[model samples]
Target chain A: MQDDAKLIEFIKTDLARGKVTGKLGANDDLIETEILDSLGIMKLILFLENNYAVKISDEDLTLENFTSIMSINSLIQRKRAAQGA
Target chain B: MDFSFTDTQVLQRESIVEFARRELNDKVRENDQAGGFPLENWRKCADMGLLSLLTPEIYGGLGEDLVTTANSLEALSYGCEDSGLVHAIVTQLCCIVLINLYGSPAQKERYLPELSSGGMIAAQSITEPDAGSDVLSMRTRIEGDGAGWLLSGGKVFISNGPLADIIIVFARCGAGKSAFGEISCFLVEKTAAGYSMGKPLQKMGLRTLQNCEMFFDSVGVGEEMLLGKNGHGMFIFNEGIEWERALMTAAHLGTLERVLGKSISYVKTRKQFGKEIGKNQSLSNKIGTMKLNLELGKLILYKMAWLKDQGKRATLEASLGKLFVSESLKSACLDAIQIHGGYGYMQECDLERDLRDSVAATIYSGTSEMQRNIIARMLGI
Candidate 1:
């Protein structure tokens, strides 16, 4: 839940650039809504890697993994779990 | 954290510099003036094993790391007066690196040996008339035929387009407003039916490097020619650009060093008002800034190279480095010309040529404006 809020905030502030003034729901499609383009996705990955202390491989860069805040947070959680294991 | 080159790297740089000085500079001015591609020099570079610097040993390449590759390119740029030749070599190197990174075992076995050995030249065609920086907006379309894919589109401003026997062409393979899961890359041979190249387009600078327009009228490519997975072209293209931005600007380091050395020599020897011109504060300041920019550029570039060597994605660093190094090279070239005064303006002096060549540095790979946009986006601006 905390990761969800942080990811949503990042998308609103950094990726969406204030265009997303209203509440960004966890399930809202970042890609379909055009909030995150290709470059934005890369920047978001860097943020996730640095903030969460996890590495995102090229194979992990998929539309499914980055379509929404929930998806991104889930990806972060998965990477963290993998690291811990 | 260590910035110093290894002993082997140092020797490699020296040997490449020596080879470039000995063989690459001949008829450079004439070739640039004629807007001709120096095929002889290309063959010489291949023979010198420069073409194989980034490929794996199994594919006939030296498999040098990114830092060592950057060092060799820098040395080549420093020693060779022909910026066009250097640019062409870097283009080829980037293509080779891209294929090696993403090519399948079959793809690698088929293309890497010939490309690394300089038996065949390759071009990466992505830019279109409407889509230079906005690559996703490209109109190139690829449809899956019963047997293979049919590529139909045109690419402009393609380096080595005329000379490349194999071209990596990007086309939209899926329906999407976004580049994700839409773009795909194809390795189209020059012999492919309906594939044609226009005559080389004359350019303002880097004239020795050939630039041409490529047209495909339903060119057939086998399924085997697809690079990476379908819909992975955007990722592959971005990765290739990252590498290109980081490593291609290395040649500018050599050019900057050469321009700085020549400017300093001229200012110290040339007399004005009964004294050496370099003694003046204005002249000295300009040279000092050139030195400063050179050092700063080196720091940004070498750090980017080091980051890539550490297996880290350096998209941000690559943009920052490309922005700084390219703009600095342009400024240094202008300062070199100003320091040389009239002699610099003359074609015989070659400072003007460097200035002309420097303009394209800010435009190619990605423009200065594009680099700033990427940096700003990374900063969340």
Candidate 2:
């Protein structure tokens, strides 16, 4: 499975789960746009934790960390590589 | 924004509902009739750490955030029959959350453990016979006596008044001060001298939790009892109220769902005009409206909770949630009563109790009118 494809799918599913609609863009404000409010982030964190097998510490959970599909995918790759995955 | 709870949240919700069902329900009618507080149920809830839903574990609380707390309360309301019992729990939780957020370390050390462990029942006393919704109009005052503060005032419509060991009292200080900025909240213990309760009020609903009046005449407390800054207590009060208004009726969303399901079953099974009442367009439409309200109410409240969990100031969202759910539940309860017909009018089978409980919702924690004011103000209307 391509990581980018899967990440896009995850984001789409999350968007649907929240019943929020908009054109996917790299710069959408997740919270300001009402896309991924508090619970959505928690759910996303849980999803990433399970699927990526990456332990996301409290400090790492930030808007900076998950603002875009590229950001999340890059962070996942970095973490997985650091873990020698 | 997401209506579905996460795994832990779902479990928390289930556990609270189970705890309420196992510990409460059967005794609700008797307690409601007698206007008595549910001491044993209070203990049971505390043992389950139900009271600490909002408090952090650092202060001997569960330390969960707003979403988990909302889920727990929703389940508790769903499984529990006595709105009075649930109201008392909500009142205590509201007060304790403020204590955890703003109280001194000594205050937390003393009260959080006691409250979370069910060592004592708690109350939030701010409504006075005169104060009502215009909080600044409070006649209660805390005089800065040479040896601690002397409290002289009375509060009415206080939930859990008869049972609280420590009641959080909001008072207006500096009589000439600005209307919105000079309020203070104090943690007054029930055992304090000159602190007494009047006969519990016969409430329109939620009677099992012991709604009543309390008088604080020369009630004294040390400097340490002040929660937050003296003049900034309105901040703490409003914070508690925001959380209360947002999450308190969450369980009622589930209650709405339950009532809708009940109504559907009634209309489906019971023969009316030689057919199921649900087959009639009017009855189905009523249930449909109820279902719509229930789903939308849940979405709004959960969104508010999500906002809180993200460190966002969700004042507007919370007000919106409160407005929608409180008004929506009114619709649900009225429909439930209609579906049950004469049986709903009777004192049997919890529809009456549910109706009574819903009546109190539009009034407490900021009335529906007040909620609209907040929402409109937020909208700059």
Candidate 3:
């Protein structure tokens, strides 16, 4: 139920599916590979906010932060740290 | 689960229908023939707070929720014969919706009042000569210069482009890790240096609404004008397009009702073989299909509206609704023209004009093909 595990599970199950024809690694690019498109990006953002109780503001909406499972975990960690939780 | 409109919503819809019927129909044919923008009707809608349906109350808006706003737009499109004017209103409202969604406090304070009051018209500049549906492929570049930003690009087929007081320009600001992530939106004033608009582009339909080509030749804008963040333009566009696909075309539901009404009236009264056309199984079957399409379209749109009102992500719902309603509208118009036969082909009957306007429904706000692609992608195809 940790944030990182939850994110990976949701991304692989909900967004990736058969759209990602090739293997997806932890640091593989979701956007460049077209595994996660604009709508997928949105769904991921919504999922992160809803499940993790974090607000991904406009500034946080970036490829560097959302292009991979690793990057997404980094963003969540940074946000949680800022909240001093 | 509740399908009935509240008393207040019913009153609002009735008043809007009455106002549009009384004030928005004058010179519509002439305007269409000349391809003129209905500034008078635009101002009338502003005065009636139609322009402010989605804005916050602090910014002089009626602040209607998505469902109510969709209902009001449906009533307006039903009463108003000029589809172009309705098109223009929705385009302006789309710009307003983006501003409200992404604009900073100061930006909202600066623009929302004027936008809500109709003192300033707005356009969204995204499509380019090469980029129609592939928005991220746009070559419009935005580079930073420490103090401000430089924007240089040309946008084509921009609704409200010719007369807009301000425009939301989407441009590429960074290479990022992906092509889709580097785009950023800037609020550019029409009067800004090196900003110019081409002559209003004449079109096959929706002529009463102006579409134009715009150029931003290294136009400089302050940091204050950077909507959302520097590299969040794609997100802004995605959000805006989702709204447009869902709510902007809500009027088409009303257009379906209008088309069905006209068809029904024609079939009921226009006699052939000494009997009403509605009496024929073949002709009546077409009318039945139109009715079915209208009912289904309204249900989809209303459900989309309700979902939006509940603050849900509706990418799938929006694309489905847009595809269904737009394709259905085109078919209904064709059926209407067929029902009216020779009279429908004539300008006097106005069904031909309606048909022309309906064609653009599928083309704009993402084409039916694009909708299909979005849906297929969501399905993991």
Candidate 4:
């Protein structure tokens, strides 16, 4: 949960880019709500790879891993843990 | 940062060009006129190891890098007079690269050796009656069976459909989700029951490359045949298309170079008003523009290839390169024909054929409009 706020801020600021109204929840369905398109997903992957230094392979590109800010945060934390181990 | 080819790469390119010229150019006119796929020429390309350029050595391939593979494709297109043949070869290469990238270990062990050696042909079937640019709208359906899947749908405009021994078919696996999670692909063999192919479709250009419609009626495929994970078809497709858009247009680079060379030679030798036509500023300017486009096109293509070789993403670069090279190649082809005058219109002159073939470049591997949309999206517009 350390990076949840950072992940949410990045999605709202960088990806949504003022498209979201009021507040974007951490558990909001990114795909179902159309907040993150295919290109947005690609950009998110690039951001996680560059900012977090966690390499995401094709297998990690599932809908479950990218469904929400919380899910994405979990993915990054898991990748970081794996790297540290 | 260094852009020069290595000594070995330079020699390898030369040998490939020479081999293509000797073996692939035979009866090209006849083959194109008949709209026939040249099986003999395909076998020659396989024997020359052209088919195995990018497959890893573990799978009976040369294990060449992306730059080398692009270089060889450029050389092959330059020396071969048959644009259709070059297109077919590039299509196979795209499928091979896709399988290499996403195939399971068991799938690789079963398919790579034969595909790499050109002992079998493969096609990627994604387009449907209603789906061309809008892939998410495709209606092909795959339903889960006991331990397998039942595929039922039809695909149109499949490049190697007529002759492919195995086809990678994308189908809808679920509903009420985004394209990223709704689509799945399966590897279906030609011998599968209830699978059938329509006759080759007639086309104005690239006539020798056969394109056809395919149908699958409850064709059963084991779960093992599913490529990658379920719901990952769109991702797999996007990844594979980057390679296709980049390297397939590498062949267009060769076509552009050949057209520029021919235009230059004709202008220098052909006389108009008692002087060489090269003396005409208007005509010379066209040739000059052709040269400029070819050079710029090469730079974009190589940059994309270099990005892929470095294990970096090149989605935007690939779209930009595809758009630029495809449009410029069409312009170059037309200029070559115009510069050649009446003689160029003749089928024997071959510039007309090049022009006909160039039209498809803008239309396939994602259209020019789609490329622009991708570029805009990448720019966050």
- Top DockQ prediction, candidate number: 1
Lowest-scoring 10 consecutive residues by lDDT in candidate 2 chain B?
A: B173-182
Question: For model 2, how does the per-residue alpha-carbon lDDT over B1-381 read when each residue is reduced to its tens digit?
Answer: 245668888787788778777878777777777877777877777878788777777877888888788878788887777777777777888778788778889998899888888787788989987677677678999888436888898999888787779999998766642322357788988889999999877877788868779999888878888887766655566567777776676766767776787788888898877988789888899999998888788778878888768754567777788778877877888888898789878877678878888888888888888878766644434
| DockQ, cand. 3 | 0.35
DockQ per candidate, 2 decimals: 0.62, 0.02, 0.35, 0.45
Decide which is better by DockQ, 1 or 2: 1
- Docking quality level of the chain pair in candidate 3: acceptable
Residue-pair clash count for candidate 3: 0
Order of quality (DockQ): 1, 4, 3, 2
lDDT of 4 by residue, B1-381 (tens): 798999999998999899988888879888989999999999889889988998889999999998999999999999898989889888888888888888899988888899888889999999998988777788999998539889999999999899999999999888755746788888999999989999999999999998999999999989889888888888888888899998877999998888888899999999979999999999999988988888888888999999899898888899999999999999988888889989989999998889999999999988999999888877766
lDDT score, candidate 2? 0.76
TM-scores, one per candidate: 0.97, 0.78, 0.93, 0.95
Per-residue C-alpha lDDT of model 1 across residues B1-381, encoded as one tens digit per residue: 577888999998999889998998879889989998999888899998889999999988898888888889999999999999999889999899878888889999999889888889999999999998787888999998537889999999999999999999999887665656888888998999999999999998999989999999999888889888778888888889888987777999889988898988988899989999999999999999989988998888888888888877789889998999889999999888888888788998887888889999999999999999999998889
Sorted into a CAPRI-style docking class, model 2 comes out as incorrect
Worst 10 residues of 2 chain A by lDDT: A34-43
For this target, which candidate reaches the highest TM-score against the unseen true structure? 1
lDDT of 3 at B291: 92
Write the residue-wise lDDT of candidate 3 on B1-381 in tens digits.
689999999999899999988999878788889998889889999999988998999999988898999999999999898998888788888888899999999999999989988999999999999988776678899987558988998999999999899899999887544545578899999889999999999899899989999998989989999888777788889888877876656888888889999999888998889999899988899999989988898888888888778876677788899999989989999998998898888898888888899999999988899989888866645
Clashing pairs in 4: none
